[model samples]
Target: MKIKYAIIGAGPTGLGAARRLNELGEKSFIVLEKNSYAGGLASSFTDEKGFTWDIGGHVVFSHYEYYDNLLVEILVDEYLEHQRESWVKSGKVWVPYPFQNNIRYLPNQKKWECVRGLLPGERSEEEPANFFEWIINTFGKGIADHFMLPYNFKVWATYPEMMSFSWIGERVSVIDLKTVIKNILLERDQLSWGPNNTFRFPLKGGTGSIYRNLAETLSNHILYNTSVVSVDQKNKIITDSLGNTFEYEFLLSTAPLDILVTKWLEKSPETLINAADMLKHNGVIVVGIGISTSKKDSRCWMYFPDDNSPFYRVTNFHNYSPNNTPVPGQGRALMCEVSYSEHKFVDQNKVVDDVEEGLVTTAMIDDEDRKNIISRWSINVNYGYPIPCLQRDEALKILQPALESMDIYSRGRFGGWKYEVSNMDHSVMQGVEWAERMITGQPETTYRIS
Candidate 1:
């Protein structure tokens, strides 16, 4: 088959591009997805007990107006607006989210340590060499030791010193010494800090419903269960697993950059191959446990920084929407994210048991409540997180432009290899922007490596 454009992967990015192309009345493009359904990593599944769970804790919030507008158009009235109620578990105490802002909840001695480190004369003039140095330089030793260092290490599955600080943009909350001091003195809580403070979710179907609806609008253009096996970049030809071939002028790939370069490309440059190997990532095991009743009292999510829990984050999935659980008020669920990599290995077969033990150890579930768990479901995703390591930018610098020159526009979470722009909104906009650049000669602005 011959086409003007071929989009690989039917996730948000691919769907976004295809949706925009349909809106523009362009009909020369085809989307090929390996999975039977769309949404890629953003998809949801239901357990035997009828509780719905997302791949991870996926909340709908956007930094771009276009992405917001697109959701409004697709989901229509089938979405829920929610105020973020998040917390952090420090031993037995529950500190409100943004642990730095709510240090008043800490013990007297701990509070003094945090506040004393925040006092003047700790700021450094030299630049930070990595995320660890950056955190200490920006937040001082107390906050870093208390929350930032441990929590980041758990989430990233890599040492903070081994990762780069460039991707920390708005993903992490930078400290405000004055505001923190005022909050501590006033014994007040500061809950609003990140972009997801107020977000939305699908009221009926799980997070995947938004993308499924969007895909439904362009269903005829997408080819499901078709995996691209090889890419003849020189001739602009793609061969799928079923012995089918497609010829295209422009290619938009949402596959992982390393996989695309190493597995699919017929012949890759030595530097690009080495760069692909340098890219590091962590896997995630999302374990959802559905209980007969609610777990916490209206809290949306909680962060686990200490080793009390093997999981780094636990979200109250039932709070996202009533339909997420089997019954409205009587049924509830807990969704926990446990990350694993070379640095931190996990036993896949025993992960569910580990999560259960972690919950009891962290006091998330009591002995009586543990017996009330109606169903248990776990999914181990290989590409759970794209780590922003010290060598990531250098690798992307060598990989991206080389592929772009060959008519390959690789953009998305793993496709672009940029965690800062890897949110659902940013991933979709990257696709839309790529399509706009191809069809209208517009300059791409989303995935620039600096």
Candidate 2:
């Protein structure tokens, strides 16, 4: 097949690109998706027991007006809006989300330790050298020791020293000691912090429903169950696993950048080969535990920094949408996430059993409530988050330009290799912006090649 544009992967990015191409009345384009379904990392599945599970914790919140307006047009009233209710469980104490801002709930001894580290003379005055140093510099040693360090390590599954803190932008809450102390003195809660403080979820299907619906609108232009194994950039040809080929003027790849450079390219250069090596990432195992009517917990999700939980984060899925359970509002769906990488290892076969035990150990569920467990569903994804190591920007600078020179563009979570702009909205906008740039003379905003 030959086309003006060839989009790989039907996740938010590809779907957004294809959808925009259709909107712009561009006819010569095709979307190739490896999965039987759309949504990629944002996809979901319903088990035999009828519990729906998203690949990871995904909430609908937007930073762009275009994305906000897009969701309104797509989902209409088919979603639920909720104030973000998130918490962190540490030292057997439940602190509100942004653990640093709500240290008042900590035990007195530990609470004072957190405050002492934030004192004027306590924090290091040096500019942070890495993510670990940034944590210490911003939150002080007390908060770092008690929450930030361990919690971040658990989530990233990569050592902080190996990461760059440039991506924290709005993902983290940088609070002043005065705010922390004032909240403690007044016993107040600071729950709102990030862009997701107010978010939405599909009323019935899991988070994937939005993308799945978008894919449906572009079905005629999509080739499902197809995987591209090689790209002859010199000749502008793409070859899939079945040996089928596509000739294109421009190609958009939403696959992992490392794989694209090292594996898919016909002749990868030594420079590109070394650059791909610097790109690091972790895997994620989302374990979904659905039970019969456990005591209600209003918090949307909770973070676990201690060994009490084998998972780093757990979401109250049923609270997001009762349809996540077999019968609406009849039970609880606890979606647990555990990240793994070279720096961290998790035994997959025993993880579910370990998660169940961790749930009890962390007091997320009562010891006797195991009998109410009705369903267990899990998905293991190899390319979870793109770790923002010190070499990321340098690597992207090299990889992106080389591919663009060959009329190929890679953008998405792993495609762009940027965790900061890898959210659903950002991924979609990357695609939308890319499509506009291609069809018109407009310059892209979301994923730039600079």
Candidate 3:
């Protein structure tokens, strides 16, 4: 089959691209998704017991007006708005969401150390080499040692020293010395921080509902269960696992760049292969536990930096929407995220038990609560967070333009290899922008080849 545009992966990016193409009255394009359904990693699943769980704790917040309008248009009034009620579980205390600003809740000695280390007097004209140095230089040794270092290690799996700090834009809350001291002195709660301070979520279906509904509009153009195995770039033809061949004038690949360059391409250069090797990511094991208790606390999610929990973050899934649980008032859901990489390995067989045990140890759930477990669900995603290593830019520098030269546009979370611009909205916008660029000769803004 011949098409003007062959879009790979029916995730947000592919869906966004298709949506935009439909808007532009373009009809010669088709989207190929390997999965039976759309939404990619942003999808959701329901357990046998009627408890719904997202792939991870996904919250819907956008940076673009177009994205916001699109979702509102798709979901209509089926979305619920929420104020972020996040916290960090440190020892036995619940520090406010920005752990740095609420160090007063920490023990006296630790608090003193954090304050003592806060006075900024540095003379480093040169940029910090890695995330470790960046943390120590930015937040000092106390905060770094107490929450930043260990928590980051658990979340990233890769060592902070080995990763780059450029992706830390808005993702990490840097300390404001005056605000920290003021909040500590007045004992104020500083939780209103970050762009996701207020967000929206689907009222009935899990987070996947938004994307699934969006895809429903362009269902005819989507080819599900069609996995592309190889691409003959020279001939502008692609072959799927089922031996079906497609000829395309342009290809927008939302697949991982490494897999595309290494496995899909007929031939790859040694340098390109080495560059692809430099790309690093952590796998996520999301364990969804449903309980038979209605929670009174309105906290949305909590971060676990300590060793008491095998998971890095846990979300009160039911709090996102009332319909997340089957029994509503009688059911509650806890979605836990455990990140694993080569540097930090996890025994998949025992991860569920570990998560439950850790929850008990951390006081998230009690022994009595364990017996109330009604349903359990878990999904292991191989490509979770794209680690921003020091070598990432150098590698992308070599990979992106080379692939683009051959009419291949890799845009998405893992496809772009940019954690800075890898949020749901960003990924979709990347795809939309890619489509606009291909269709109208517009210069791409959200994703840059450079």
Model 1, span 314-340: residue lDDT tens = 998889998989886567789999999
Q: Whole-model Cα lDDT per candidate? A: 0.90, 0.91, 0.90
lDDT of 1 at 67: 93
Stretches of model 3 off by over 4 angstroms after superposition: 120-126
Residue 334 C-alpha lDDT in model 3: 95
Model 2 lDDT per residue over 21-87, tens place? 9999999999999989999999989988999999888999888998888888889899999999999
In candidate 1, where is summed lDDT lowest over 10 consecutive residues? Answer: 116-125
Clashing pairs in 2: none
Return the TM-score for each candidate structure: 0.98, 0.99, 0.98
lDDT value, candidate 2, whole model = 0.91
Give a tens-digit lDDT track for model 3, residues 1-450: 999999999999999999998888899999999999999988988889888899888888999998999987988999889999999998888888899988989999989888777776632336798999898888888888889999999998999999999888889888767887898899997878798999999988798988899899999999999999999999999999999999998899999999999999888788889999999999999999999877587999999999888999999998988888887656789999999999998999999999999999999888788999988789999999989999999999999988888898898999999999988999999989988887798998887866
Model 3 local distance difference test score: 0.90
Worst 10 residues of 2 by lDDT: 290-299
Query: For residue 33, what is the lDDT in candidate 3?
Result: 96
